[model samples]
Target: MILDALFFLIQAGLTLFFWAILIAAILSLLTGFGILDTRNRFVWALSDFFYRVTEPAMRPVRNRLPNFGNVDLSPLVVMLLVQACMLLVGAIRGYMIRGGLYF
Candidate 1:
């Protein structure tokens, strides 16, 4: 029961983080294309929030990657890594549910 709850919690956290990254990526593209102007107060606030939420996870990835002038691939890399983590968590939960270690 507790293991199931833990898995649920892990899944919830991953889902939230996944949405955050997706939003940040879309925001970056919109702002890049001038569709979302940051000068508006509300837009600015939301943009700042997204940056703060994503930067902690993204900055390290960005630092390790080569600087690509006028382009950033860190978000894509982060998304892929997050997906990998989700798979890992699901695999662990599956293993636990499948009778655990028997022997």
Candidate 2:
């Protein structure tokens, strides 16, 4: 029972992280296109929040990746990695449920 709850929490957190990376990417594009103005306090705060939430995960990936000039691929890469982690977590939970291992 506890393992199931733990797995659910892990999956939920990974899902949130996945969406954060996605939103940060979309916000960047909008700001770049002038559709979103950082001068507006609300827009700036939202952008800042997502940036803070996603940057730590993205920084190493950004550093290792070759520069794409104006385009950033780190968010996409990070989202993909987060998706993989979610899948792995589900698989592990299934395996454990099947009596494969115990935590």
Task: Return the top candidate by TM-score.
Answer: 2
The residue-by-residue lDDT of candidate 1 on 34-94, one tens digit each, is 9999999998898889899999999999999999996989888998888999999998777
Best by lDDT: 2
Q: Give the TM-score comparing model 2 with the true structure, all chains together.
A: 0.94
Clashes of 2: 0
The C-alpha lDDT values of all candidates are: 0.87, 0.92
Give the per-residue lDDT digits (tens) of candidate 2, residues 1-103. Answer: 6787788899999999998889999999999999999999999999999999999999999999999899899998998899899989888887886895755
Instruction: Count clashes in each candidate, considering only residues at least 3 apart in sequence or on different chains.
Output: 0, 0
Task: Give the worst 10-residue stretch by lDDT in candidate 2.
Answer: 94-103
